[model samples]
Target: MRWPLTDAARVVAEARVRQGWSRVRAAWFPILQAAVAGSIAFAVGHSLLGHPYPFFAPVSAWIALGFTSDRPLRRVAELSVGVALGVGLGDLVVHVIGTGWWQVAVVLFASAVIARFIDRGAMLTTQAGVQAIVIVGLPALGASGGPLGRWTDALVGGAVALAVAVLTPSDPRRRTRAMARVGVEELAGVLRTLARGLAAGRPSDVEDALVRGRASQPTFDEWLDTATGARDLARVSPAARRHRDELTALVQAAVLSDRAMRNARVLTRRALPLLDPGPTEHDLHAVGATVVDIAAATDDLADSLATGRTPDRARARLVAAAQRLDPFVLAPDDWQVQSLVLLQRSLVVDLLEIAGVSPRDAREVLPPI
Candidate 1:
């Protein structure tokens, strides 16, 4: 009873600590990005063009728009184009129609509509509309510097933003590598939980494994996306590219292994309702032990992927243990033996493939489990 209460308290405490850390770290990323953008905009606009408005305005707009989403380039381009069109249209309209509510309404509406059409171009509409207002809404004490000034400013700001984005770009390869490490660690965690469930012969353990397997899918998808993006960026180092590919394959293999494990869990759960006449303690322990070994091997494979280091020793040990659990050789009637074999085979195939060995060659080296 005390143990359960203590465990609950500890979980709560850990959750709070994690929450606090996340909040603290969250600010660092956005602020650092914003500052970098602002500095670049200022330097380019103020020093080179002698016009700070061009740099600051576009950069500020990018930051305000939250360019950190999945598509930073698209967002920046959209907003910059929107502003440019809006400013250009507004200037053109003011020249044609004298300042009035109707003129303002017309320019805003026209700019918004054109902006919408310009790029996929939802923001273009807003961009043009706002620019129209800026050009004609305010009264001028002195002669207008004209549309040229506004256009120049918008162009400068956009150019600065684009330059910053292209120059100090975030490498997708690095992101993939980071995710691989986390994914592998998570794989290890999942395997441990799964092994425990199988060992206890509980339907709940199998169900939990299924749930974890589903949850893990996003990690693989995200890694794939990052890898594809990084490969496209072509800015990653040669070592990074190779490593990224290896990690990608490793994750793909993990997904397959997870699926196999899931199927085995389902079988185990189904067997739970069926009556087992009698089983020797030794037989039961063997089932549990085999499941744990399978998990350990899978975890080792995941670790290798995360760290770029192969688990040669663990792989060998797993191969040896899997052979011992062979249904054809060891325990013929044990259904658990069949399930364990499936997991073992799936993981071995994936691991070997990730190591760049051919499937036939891997089979030659790996004995049937």
Candidate 2:
């Protein structure tokens, strides 16, 4: 019992460590940008603006920027407005009513109401209320300029954060492409797993494939989200506008891949029952070989998407595979095997569309029934 418990503990610990490392790798760049933005905001407020204690400057900058490249320009503008509104309201309340519990409530209410009136963004209202509360709670001492010194510091911070966000050189499509590759590769892995199961006539392997395909929803969702964000950024950022078409393509690909994965899961589920009764006389080997070919083509798609290259090779491979998906040629008598082939045809068509082939052309690539 002790050994089993210890092993489980070790496994959980390793998994958590891997998750932490992955997060670090994904967020290190955004974290570094936030750090630099905060430092710059503090320097501008304390040195140039002559604010002795402009702590809100860095706080405002960090809050505005957060830690993701997915922020749209409008979001940044909203955050800046929220911070400024909150600071201004907090300053007024502190001077007029004095800092107390009641003052905090009043400032929060005022900030929230004013922010909501200005914009409908939830972050704007939430940040306004939070900043107002902080300002009310903390005493404003050692101020150099005037009663509005902290308010000016907050403005400087927001401006610096906005400047940093705009001036940062970033390819909006990079993260989208990365996520696409991840989603496509996972889809390919499911196909490969299904192939292995079919080749071996193993119900357990098919079951595993179905489970994996189901668990892959989050990856596809993330890919879609990333592509959408890239498209939004392209629309707003002049530097990224040129990549809008490509980002749109990626978004479409993400959608098609998601459909392909769903079909694969269904195919795997259908194949599981046939294997449960043990191997039959059906030509599952041929079916398995076709799945393997599709998996190879999926790998090609992943490579093309990751490198932003034309998926010519992947398209050709999928077309060739599609031509071979004739149910009559592969399984003339077995309806079950033929059904699997039919599902594969739909999945291949989706992959072909993802590779830039139109739906009509993709369907034409398949042989007539």
Compared to the true structure, candidate 1 yields what TM-score? 0.60
Task: Tell me the tens digit of each residue's lDDT in model 2 across 252-289.
Answer: 99999999999999999888878767456666999999
Model 1, 218-310: lDDT tens per residue? 555655565555554343444345445554564465455445445544544443343233553224445556656656665666566546676
lDDT score of residue 342 within candidate 2: 99
Local error of candidate 2 at residue 178 (angstroms):
1.5
Name the top TM-score candidate. 2
Which residue pairs clash in candidate 2? none
lDDT of each: 0.55, 0.85
- Using lDDT, give the best candidate's number: 2
